[model samples]
Target: MGFFKQVFKSVFKNIIDLSRPIFTFENNELKFKINSEYYYTFALNNYETKTRHDSYILEAYTINSDNLFVEYVHVDNDVTWNGLASSFFVNLFKEKLPINSMKIIEKKEFEHYEFITYKINDEFTLNFIYIYEINKDNFIIEKNAELYINLLQSFQKDYKYKFDKNQDLEFDINISIVKENALNGYFNLSN
Candidate 1:
């Protein structure tokens, strides 16, 4: 009975592994290709910030070689400041995608959060933009202004995204602080 159980477990593990997508990174480009018609690539450029932090900017391009599909920028900061602002923007941009599937493709210790890329369709790919914040005495304050520009002549003007019922896609910027022993306060921009 024990021998049979071990055999079954090995077979199950192989099946699960075969169902996952394959990712590859070579020559400074990270790529995932499902077929000729479906794929995404990130062209990464890294530089040093004036403050001496390592920074990178990634441009996500589509299969047909549309260069300006989307852009993501990140600055390597301590873990405490890394993901706070990016999470908010990620939640906002995710609402714009059809989001067939999403997974974390890469994560680094010096990076703020896991690098997540979403598969919107065969031709569209999106990634998150990460910025940092400082927390002191269990309190943190952040201020940001975002300006979006459309550079494509073929951009859709009437496209709309339908979100899942359980998905919260609302964008209400606010301040939230969490301490080890207590909750600070939430300041909602809407109110």
Candidate 2:
């Protein structure tokens, strides 16, 4: 009976999310809390790169895709939540600057959300991350990527210009498909 219970528990855990909501929408604003465990797990794995830059895969995939831990993620890291976010900005900015001068300008981790600012160049203030986190019995989900993409898609909010990451990306037409659904009740997005 114990064995059966363990198997069922494992199966059910994957089927249903018995934790905080991964994506939340309300009011005229949308917020996201990236999953720390998923970020750590993805960082823990190893992979082969198609470029010489150590962070090529990590930066490119995370930027190209709408989510960070998408199927294209094929990189590794040894930093915590803040550290990885830090690296993501560093590698991102370094792409254009290519200057070996990256430093932490500021770091603020609140009870729910956190921000890590990096000074990779003269205009470092532009390259910062004010993101949220999701914790499920200490388990992490891939909400950060979702928020990043959604923020840029639904909100037209992005920092690609600051780092010159996608400076050449020209959206000739307004093909952005956004679904504006009214949230039913008050959702205390205090995770």
Segments of candidate 1 deviating more than 4 angstroms: 1-84, 111-115, 121-125, 135-191
TM-score to native of every candidate shown:
0.25, 0.29
Model 2, which residues run further than 4 Å from truth?
1-18, 22-30, 33-89, 92-97, 130-191
* Clash totals, every prediction: 0, 1
lDDT per residue as tens, model 1, 22-139:
3433465544433334434555344111111111211111111122122222222322333344444444334443444454432222222223333344333333323222211111
What is the Å distance of residue 89 in model 2 from its true position?
5.9
Root-mean-square deviation per candidate? 16.5, 16.5
Model 2 lDDT tens row, 37-137: 22211222232212212221232212222212221122234312323443443353354344467576545454444444444445333223343333210
lDDT of 1: 0.29
